[model samples]
Target: MSGLQPLGSVDICLVTMPFVDLCRPSIALGLLKSALKSSPYRVSVSYGNLLFAEKVGVERYGLQKFGRQTRLAGDWVFAQAAFPEHVTDTSDFAQQIAQDIRRLAGLDRDPETLNRLAELVLDLRDQATAFVDEMVESVLAQTPRIVACTSVFQQHTASLALLRKLKERDPELITIIGGANCTGVMGVANIESFPWIDVIFSGEADDQFAPLIDHLMRSGLAGLDAACLEGVITKTSAIQLRDVSGKDLPCAFVSDLVTSPQPDYEDYFTTLRQVSYRDQIVPGIPLESSRGCWWGHKCGCTFCGLNGHNMRYRAKRADQVLNEIRSLRQTYGIERIEFVDNILDMGFFDDLLPRLANEPRKFNIFFETKANLTRTQVGRLKAAGVGWIQPGIEALHDQMLKLMNKGTTNAINLQLLKYACEFGLRVIWHVLYRLPGEEDAWHGESAKLVPLLHHLMPPTNFVPVTVQRFSAYHDDPEKYGLKLQVAPGYLDIYPLDVERIGQLAYFFDSNLDYPSAHDRHDGFLALNKAIRDWKRAFANEDAPPILGMRDEGESIFILDTRACATERRFRLEGIQADVLRCCDPALRSERLAPVLAEHHGRRYTESAIAQAVEALRERRLLVEVSGKLLQLAVPGEIPDLPARSTFPGGIDAPPNLAALIGASAKTAVAA
Candidate 1:
């Protein structure tokens, strides 16, 4: 490490490839750029994703970017250009991609659109080769000594293609690869399968990246050894880093998030302004206040492989987070901030949220949190300028939740939806089916309950459970009554043997014991139909369903416009209004009577309260789940929230109250 080059002597390039969202920069590369600020290396990030999007047309690139990840159509499109010798025939690949596009579009089984899409796939494949050549020329213009690519989601093939071309043109250039996809066995396999990659970091490289660069700059690759780099797998050390079965050795992880440098996003904004489709994108800066999952450390989700080998939760100090946000906002002049944490730190509730809520300039923020949030917490999230959240409401059945070890009940998830709707927070979630140990009858029961929730937000879509590497299901398939194989998509993309493909693959195809194929399809038909109807109802901009309530001194007024509403309006008085008010946060059936009696300052029998509750339930004013009664209507005073469809750009501007609810309920509930 001694006698290294002076600061900013060695040139390095960090790359982000296609299939990544065009609306955000790579936090991984951004952090690395900042991490090398004090070192002798001068880093420049190459935004190849934006460049490719411009070349292939932004709209078409988006179609592949947001398409199903299990299909890996994006990877296959670039695979032809990356490894020409292996992927000679793309006829079958084109047909599979065309069918997938048809499925995603909800199109009928027609050959006309499929034929056009098949041709388009071939055209894109050709464009991909030219795009890689363009990227190689762009990166080489900088004349960097080392080039590193961040591979996550569908960027693997594109990264490989760029690096392969770079190495072909310049044999002395060092090639490095890392990211979520390069963790554990996948990283080891990457070095073993692809001769172009010289070094692969298996875990978090926040603490190790700069030192490795120092070693390379001083002694060059010839002096580099396994002893010099701790968590990195070099080409010479791939065999020693793996066990007999070719799994990864234990790697060290970053223990403290406080020391991680603030990401540099100057390159992203610079490249974005040069793109033709820049106006269509409203960029959101990605920031991470924490890492890993706290809940997963206790009872991990069965199908999640997000944390890799590091499930320990760590967060930056509240002051550090606040300072970072202030600095980023002042520097970038962007109001949209997206937290890339796997799960929100619960401690943020006490310090970080309250601080953000008090800021003068509000930010449109997004975070992922557990679904078991209380009503007050949801309100705080909205008040803190958090307009979007993915609360992980995977299923509506308690049994299915238990099967996934979610540690939450259906009632809790429903309550979160109700509160998020009331507070104008847009929720992004979906239903996950095909879970092991799930009963076919659960779908039927969930379908029956779907209509009762027309006023709330609907799921984006329903997807089958995937067995991912590092997940509990993938680690011990026998325990969950599952048999696993590499997903079919990998076979089309990679020309490797089954064993090597298994090591490089993250998603997998699985077989479960319960819920036969016929039963699974038939049982989900009703639920699928219900969700479709719900989405359609929400699509109507003129008069979407609105179920809201207003509190008057004497009576409570309810306005109902749902498709399943029994009446347009209802006025509740006396005990009925009292019962609805008592159930604001939802109460168990047995506790409802006691709470109502206490509110009225008089003793009331359980039978009398039950009658009132049943009346409200019959009117669709209240719904019961797992013996807990929850008021279905949001407060009429609260304006309508923006759904994901309305604001596809992720910009949640303050809603115009007069436009949202002025026409619907102005006569019903006057101030």
Candidate 2:
């Protein structure tokens, strides 16, 4: 919790570079730091991201970090500094990226907007060298014998730039790189491409990092035999580590997450205090209760490549999770906890949520989960202080959901959304399209369905699906009737051959020829427009779209203010009210009829129940998906949930970079 120890007191300095979110620490570095607590080496973490944000202005830094993924703008900017000889000219690169952005984002080619984007890209690209130089000097000041960098997302090029400079400054200083980007073939590619990188760690280095450090301290890099190090990939051992097919051997994962040390985030907090815009930032502590996707283990989503080589599910005990949360809160005096798990452990619903609900102190939590959550489970999540969730609601059509292998139908996805709205939980989700074998009609149907649910939260964005390595589509593109190639943007970012780039690339651009491929454009446009309107409806703080219901003994009152509402209010009684109550958790027509019959002690035919459901659907009170009917109107008063905008220093929107820089300058002058 104290400031970073004096220079020359640190041995292994783990670095987290630019473009990573400054609102949280690098859990990878934090875990490795704690893993080395008992080792002879004195481990320290250098939050280069905080330092770089201070120098370049946080707003501009965020623009690149949270910007369009396909653009790889952050990587391109730092590629200039990292690979100067390769990426010499930017006139063509800038023009190409600008055009790609317009096409992908469906933005009109407005000259001024495009010119401003170009200017920002070039300006940031120009500043990369100086920032990398400053970071190198800062890291060298610590006099660390071994410097390691965690590279994920846009951090790859920046990490390379810093380590390259450090190696140039001190050739004896060991430079190591590892993270999501450096797994399997990507790790081998990095080792082969960058001569400065002395070692590359693939896979989960949780169990291997500390031991590797111990080996280096005792034996150094000379004549080092790394066969015992499970995930270590060095230049000499890189070839030997590959299989007969020349593919790099899969890295071993930690089977038992219980034994892993709780991450040490002291460095993140210490670095945060030194940030010039510290007051503007509300930091959240990142914790992991589980690793790998349990759903993926059974039936992996076709478009997902998040788990890399390891899709086997592993989770710590419920007690371990609770203890970690309490310890982090007590240590940092912060209550916002973000779970970095790919998916919530199903056991947590029965084990962890109940414990958190019973706790005296409440913590705001964010979790990613499946969309099949029942209403009771949703209520439990709300009670457990899980205010935000990414429930993987990727599609709103049954056929589309099947294509993605989501294992949940459109009805279940809608039910989750309705429940989330009713419980005042912020749902972080998006509509993903462009799956192989997708029909144009699916998009049209989704666009039609969007307006009826304006009372619920809109998706964050509508994104075109991209093929990623380790995904079903990428692993067997031919089987899906698609051809995969390196994402075109990578050509502009990395000046490498297509084949070599393919090996290094995580995201791939797919080429599929379907009969309705061209016609699907209009359908996508309509859906995107509908989603945009849904988001706009929530913009006015004074009045938000609302469709809510209150249940009385004899009557149910439904208030409707949604854009698609037919009337201001409606009163349901007798069979209508009973049908609404019966379908609160969603039910098939046959089941609805039986339930309604049991409620009133009278026989109700399926046709009669269907007619009543249709009447409610006409008034936008009920929705039937995949033959199951669900009540759309949320029960009781809807709470005013906190919006993402309310969160301090979120990376979603761009602030004024010049203002941040000017403010920091004034602060330094005052000091």
Candidate 3:
């Protein structure tokens, strides 16, 4: 294009149906620059892909707390409500969300409900399309000689469809697809399935993409025979197609893609005036220090998709990582950033974090890691300004955890929780349910696991598990025999399995097994039973709005609500009633005061606040608190209350209420 030894390659667009906006663009940029070194083309790299928040509700409209799962549920419901004929797992999730939105909005076929639903659906589709279109146009404007796309989840389908339209307009454009979802699942997605797609590549895209782009730019067209591509599934005829292997594909090409000329972040994002997220765009370039995970433990837990139980870690040079961070900051104006790594192993942290902290950039990073990290590592994370850490804890029950191949024990999980709690770091423990073994554990032995989780609740959590073919049980069902049954919907085997098997297994696709009446009946019964048990025990209870001490701790009180000690007992002789008030808004002063008063006599003093807090603390009825501000802490059951004795200001006047005496007077005097 300009200022380079050009082989006539004008632009290269690297795309992914993104799971997160971090690192991919930067990583792609780095790789693209490396690829250009071998080419005679004037190379320019631009990234655009459909970036999705697991929950569409929050990403599209601004319901920040609305989780990806909840949004998925809402979307599933909307999709079903809109097109029930295409029922799938997504539909069921959507139905649940629809029910919830119905309840939350209090709309029963009313105009308000319909309008809200309509607006939400439109907003979802529009925002999703807009983002997809924006990235596509941005790339198209670069006049790329090559186009590559990747998908990680189902949402990418919409974005891929848009890309196909672009392809239809310009068939000569070289198109390649690769990512977690695309590489593994779609071998050679039927070219007809996506008419705009010229070639669907899988496995690792780094080595494959550069070579293909070079070939396409040099020859103006490249041949795609099944053997040349490791994993390509292409339609050769109206009735038949070919499936090729992609196992031999080279590993990701990790190198500096952009050279001497640095990026201008303001210019880049500013080009798209409406950046997707409205929150403060803490300008931090996303980059990964490594590829794959290092948790070599054989049993990573059954539900884990991270690394597919194959832990591979290739660390980037520490100095290079530090240099990149500094470069992105100085050149691109990035300050706060997130390091999107599977897990920043403790060793990496010990070396990298201290160096990073010394580098003079105040950055805020986000990461998801295993629970086996040490307290020291967590402390490092907090010190590094990591505001969010998604730890994969999966389940509290050992059996369930084993079933998921989560190698760590509940004890280890709890220890991590304790450290995070003590350190006051915001953490979200990712949990899962409905694993294959859950049914066996559900009857009795496993029931205990739920309460165990009570001890380690986090501010954010989730529990979801879907049956899959490659899980230990699914992989070797002959051992379990009749005890293990495959669900119909799970036929869409993960690409990891396809890599092993070479051909698509009928057993993995959801539609195949459920074809017959009896098979479908048995499979569905198993799923439904799991769902029922999960709902009864976990359901929305594990969801967030993290509980605090103020949430009623029943069992101790006469009415089985929050326990209340009588005010008479609490009132030391001649103590004023107004001195004990502690302004904990979490407490329902009106309702709880009478209960507290019935327990502690009408008395006023700072000691009364201390006594009430102390009493509740002793009984374990209150949540763990810091200073005067209280948080609901205890997970279950309040202790027994001592028999009540009558006191003044109604039999149920709070002992601390007396402490309130002249509290307003003090406030007035201060004013």
Candidate 4:
């Protein structure tokens, strides 16, 4: 093993931020690993993203509300799609199903629903744990002492728990915690709460970690307290009291997790984890180009963790980034490369892509960015073979966008979106609903959003967000005037304390006021109630009829009866309405018939028509494939729309302009 081969002993293990799958361990532990070289202590590094079931509940419940329809629909599609021979040969599908139940700890899922989703995630977690454990043990055999766990996502909670289990098996091991979440809340100690975590470094752990490890190796735990631990919070303190230094840590540290030979992938294995191929997967090398946000500093949105607000950008040399890319492709059969940066800078991308474009081996690439990238940037990226970019466009309202400080206006956002679409680049957008805004405001914003959906449609992507912790209003409720208290539920991860930095600490027991001018809690509350009611009504067997119109053929499938009812309520007078999903198209007859007859001329009761449609579905007259948006095999024909031509740069010609009216045409006509 390398531990015995004299690279330096592993005295400390460090995890990176967002311990989620994309965590670039190479960046977090890379520098410290290098500094320790030639030292007597051997270094073994492992990264972790912890798993707390309760936190999962909070997150999942919110997700369920936001994406319940789509995700459920996706799962059904995945289940119906036959498993490939490789997947089926690897494991027993039945056994995998059983394991999913045990792993989910009773997460909400119906008996017939695709339980494979749970199984897949559990399999990945197991593979990740086993792989990390083996690597640690290999180093530990040579007398490695410390183990560090870093996380990018909430999953780090689970990784931390696994490390604790590993610690029990080897009491001599010391566990360290550091990452984004750790950086935010590390000044406080809850040693009793998490007995496994020792020496939690709150902020950037690079410079401080090596020195701390050196002291530990020399003195064997002596002078640990007096060490220069900036965000270090020991068991002795309840709050994350900032150090006297008063300076925030650096954005990201350099690490071997990058340069070091990719973990021996011969041992690399992943079991049915939710591994998404969203990005171009380069086999060996991935890049983390920047640290913190350039924008998130001031625009602390209510439900954000300051992702875009805490801006710290340090672009690596373009040549160096390209060199790493070249080495990975040459050394290993890796063609896909993922940019793990928070947001790939446009400048960096422009420099990197043009060089790689003419290379012998075309490298597929992926990155995330905020909304409103320019048309030129999109065109350049597409030419460069960049597959996609994920951006958070959380809400559509100016007020909501302002609250989130998304840094771009809707007009700009829409323009950038159109460019991305024009360039045929896939863009994934993050969306949120039912936040702290007026009911009418939400509906108005949604109205604006629905039209834009046609402009920014997805196969492309959409991720919905509900409120979460340490975001603007939640972090400092007093300033934001948010006063709704979080009820003590299974979903609560952190106590509502004003001083805390991590978890749900800033909740109100009673409704609180925002700046007196914008206090619309009453309206927000009413809107929230309606949303909840709508959700419940959809789930209920006994509910009223619904009528909806979906664009039959334009690469789109929409389910919205809510919009029509909301429109009628606001635009017309004396109309009370309840809209619900109907298995029977006949149900559309009662309410829809009169409305359609009155509006479009001709129709019967909604329920009567809906029942006939449902019967057709049963008889195969209207076939509904689970994953598909359209009901298959229904007899129908719609005339093709006229083809539109794009002028040089996707600009539309003026409607009144004659086709013959051109520069050459004018000369010919004059002659």
Candidate 5:
């Protein structure tokens, strides 16, 4: 299957392109194929870019003298590792395209940079054209009646180019494309701009693709006949194939994900074995236990733009999830799985977690869950063979959390971190700063607790939150007091003139220009520096503990364990001990004042308690944001990982964030 197929005929060909997380095969293609495999449908999947990554990529890396296994198993390291460092630093595709257009139109600035960038763009265009030709020819060789490409991330341009080429090679092939990139107008824009993309599906195509395929098989590739398939857009007349987008088709199939068949990863595993360093591929079965985020379905996060118009929440039954997971594990002999759900189904705790916990196999799994998970739930997740989680821990301040519409408090986030550490679960969370309308005081207060969190698995990333295409920020900027920057990075990524890129680009920066680094807008810079310093210390195992609790006779001694502490230890008696214990998660100011009054009638005055809180904040022992307070120290040290050394920079200041988002930030600043 890795090589050219022998002459054969197939019903459909699904392709997953380059730059997707190579460690985890796409759950999209597999799920779609499973859905399409009804009575008369035969489905075939081709991970063309993955195959390219394995074969041609290995050969290229060999010339550079990379190690055998490293070169072979390097797909994840090379492709999915936010390897967009080069794109961000200088050779951003859209920026280059925009430059070329300007120069051609007789407007020029740095002509030399423009000339060099133009050359790079031409080279990439040539490469993409070749890839499209190759993929189309390969799929055509199998004689599939239809070819669909799963589009995500930077795969947009390549997918569009391929759809164009597929039609050029054979108009009868019925070219189609869909993914996060194709949601809403992004799809409409591509179809409106390029008429060759025969059919495009927006939003969740799982419900649309199968029925479309069925209709196409029955009615042939005639225009206006596709009116039955909702969310499927096509030209009105195939004879007059112009840049006219077809009527909007609606999605009918909810396809009860609870009872839907398990994903078919036959091709993924088949392709995995073809990787040169065969033993190096320890691929995980990418599973989806739920469709939409249950939490985000109601009061969605303000900054979250994922799920697009398809924010409706749907989850698989717990039994169905466990059965699917178990079947996948037994079938693949691979215990590691990465759940692709936007959020963990709350119902999983009732059945899936407990069942998986009791199962003999102890599979290693990873999931993303809401941060509001209780300590008991976190522990249950840990017990149930879940080794990793991406808890939605954007901030450790209630105000910041509220600004994001995260619906969870700082105390709850802290509690989740503590539980993750206590249960030995690896946490990957980010800290978003410089949020619009956020007070400078919020970050100033949040910075103090940065050092305290070093005991837990350090934040995997910290950067200013971006305005994504489908998020609440982009949906209605005015409602959230956000003025989005459209004529910038969006220009760099897509080739359309200023007007069109605004409608298509998924990522955007604020158009507000900060003339000086000293602006209040620069508050996040200092906070970012503090967080980076904290991360370095944590990585080196040098960060201090946040809490040290002990009972001596009738008195309790609680000490701030953070490094460089003046009052590392504090002794509390009676009422004071009771007050500190109430800081479990956090106690709001309104509630804290009353509780202290009730507990410490005469011993501690309101002013005295306020003074103590200020003292604690000064020592970085307490995170006092607005009225809520949390003891920042979680119970475990950041677990040292073997991949920690793979980070380009040294322990003093690791460079992942700098390599990934730092360049983008600098680009924004320069813009």
Candidate 6:
């Protein structure tokens, strides 16, 4: 390795393409650099997304649009579906685009307005192309021999366009591509379509990069073979692919996170300083503590299509993880670390949580874990500085959970919400429907439970299941009872044959086993409306703790803070009050009379106690389970969170109190 020649300047320039949040560095590019450290070739990384800053800085596009949530902005850099070339003098294109965007964002728009989106797109294309040219020229000025681009999600179209223009600027400039778009079938599809791209590399390029870099450095542009390296795809002809990406080889995940050098984030920082809106540059250092999902290997959630094909979970030792965290924190001056793991290994509770809690400087971290987490585990995670968690609570109905093969009961999902809320850990999750066996009754049952748990985070979005590649549904569509078609967005983005689009697409529109399930008369429509309102209501922080039981001497008072339900606080006394007191430590309703008679010197008939508890159940104040009765109220002061939604800052700024109290407080209070 030492025999390799020392070269000046960057011989290989890795470009990270766009559409991801600017707030986090690319873990793929970071890992690629770490894996390639053994190679003697001097490679420097570049953030091509920063080049879009040129368009953003010139006031071509408003900063408001780049706020991530904004529907549309002043300038458009990323090219979506093809604009009509025939309508050169079209005046309707810009107007149509504006109107469509306004309608989509729920802004006021007249349906009669004529559309001119095609014309506006031409102007946008010109601006975006100019921006790409300027940046490519600057990179070429460095006389780099090769430029490798990483494309994922929305980055694909933009990367393809840039590489085309870069090659047009100097056709001699070698172009290599990788990332999510370059894995599996999508990689070969892209390589065949885009002539400017010289090669495509699969997800794990550890065994692939060194030889390619050496070949480029030693041989220059001449005599370079298409099949020189593993995981490399090159042109065999005008439209054919010469792929040497040996699918059987070990991937990047096989490299230990514990042993791999901390991802070199210097390129990201350097790019950040050059961008115009440094204010928007809140970068979280990406740390891969593990890869794959332990649960997926057992019975993967069918709706999830994460971690690609690598579903076998592997994790670093606790000490190795801690040392990596310390090294990353010391090197990058940032405490926020986002784990790129598919699922937090169950072992983290044993191996990692205790050690992290003992550290002098606790990290503000985020992880995706199983929704069936215990209250004790949630508490331990918070103590270990896990500020946010995405527990997989897609639905809160036992039947739906079973249909999705989630392995956890709806009761368990609801328990997680209560526990996460009590522990002050921010829970972020979505509720998805449209499973093969899901019924309208299930959603209604979930909506009914929302009121009883207003203290916990509500579902962020209620969407139907999307068919994505590599999911259980995709692996065997008929088994899941679905017939899939390509999404319409891809028609505009790629404009290829429907069969080709279906093969290349990551997302698809699907036909269900029960098409009548989506009928207008279906009960899920009401559930959707209810969940939307619930999501809105839960975003408010100053709302009084809905499920907290307040003790007042002989009487037990409960505040009904459910915004959607028309109910007020409840008061119970005598035997009825004693019935709830037994539930404080949670005793069976059948045993309530004995506990009351033994401890409080109050005796009541079992028949009288049943009637009193039944009355409480009618009011939705008590949760009855089997013979046991658990209090609806979670005992504790509501813990704080970096609350979700449009209001974005940490801990100090919560959603407004007026918003939380909603429109029916005094009315419900009077009831």
TM-score winner among the candidates? 2
The residue-by-residue lDDT of candidate 5 on 1-671, one tens digit each, is 23643435788888887645445567788888888877498788887665555543422222111112111112222221112222332334434453534443344465554544344333333344455556667778888888888887656655666666677778787888888777666776667666777777776666667778887777666643435566666655323333433222222335477546688888876776666644543466778887777778788988787777566788888888888878987887777777878899888897899999999878778889998888789879878988788888998778889888888877788778777766777778998765777776777777766666665566766656777777877778887677886635343334456666665667776643432365664446656777877767666644435555565635666656556555766776654555565565678755666776675453466776677666666655567644577655443343333243221111111112213223344544686
Better-scoring candidate (lDDT), 1 or 3: 1
Residues 1-671 of candidate 3: C-alpha lDDT, one tens digit per residue: 11112223356655544333422244444444555556676555433321333224223332211323314322222232222234344334333443445554344755434344434444454455455555555556667767766554433454355466567657778776555544433334324445566666544455555566665676644354533544443344212433322332222333332222222233234322333432322234556666566664444444344433235666666676667778766665545455667776566687877776665555655667788777678778767656556777765556666666667765566556655654555455644544443543332333323332333333233334543433444445454332333322222212123233323221232222222445434433443343344434432433412222222222221111122222212221222122122222233333344545565454334555566656654433333211122222322332221112210000111112112223423544576
Off by over 4 Å in 1: 1-10, 226-228, 244-250, 512-521, 643-671
* Model 6 agreement with the true structure over 248-315: per-residue lDDT tens digits: 32123454545555677877776666666656446677777777788897889887777667777778
Q: In model 3, what lDDT does residue 644 have?
A: 22
Off by over 4 Å in 5: 1-8, 55-129, 223-227, 237-255, 277-280, 480-495, 514-522, 541-561, 567-578, 588-623, 632-671
Flag regions of model 6 displaced more than 4 Å: 1-8, 57-77, 80-104, 111-126, 206-208, 219-230, 236-256, 513-518, 550-559, 563-616, 624-631, 643-671
Please identify which of the two predictions, 3 or 6, would achieve the higher lDDT against the true structure: 6
Candidate 2 has what TM-score? 0.93
Steric clash pairs (candidate 2) = none
Per-model tally of clashing residue pairs: 0, 0, 66, 72, 11, 12
Model 3 stretches astray by more than 4 angstroms: 1-10, 15-115, 122-142, 190-192, 223-284, 308-310, 357-362, 439-459, 467-671
For 637-665, candidate 4 gives per-residue lDDT tens digits of 21111122211111111211122113224
Candidate 2 runs further than 4 Å off: 1-8, 95-110, 242-248, 513-520, 605-607, 645-653, 657-671
TM-scores for candidates 1 onward, in order? 0.92, 0.93, 0.59, 0.55, 0.78, 0.80
**Candidate 1, 224-285: lDDT as tens digits:** 77456666887777777667343346354899998999999998888878777778777888
Provide the lDDT at 487 for model 3. Answer: 29
Instruction: Give lDDT per model, in order.
Output: 0.81, 0.82, 0.44, 0.42, 0.64, 0.65
RMSD (CA, Å), candidate 4 to true, equals: 19.9
Quote model 4's TM-score: 0.55
Ranking by lDDT: 2, 1, 6, 5, 3, 4
Cα-lDDT of candidate 1: 0.81
Give the distance in Å from residue 61's predicted Cα in candidate 5 to where it truly belongs. Answer: 9.7
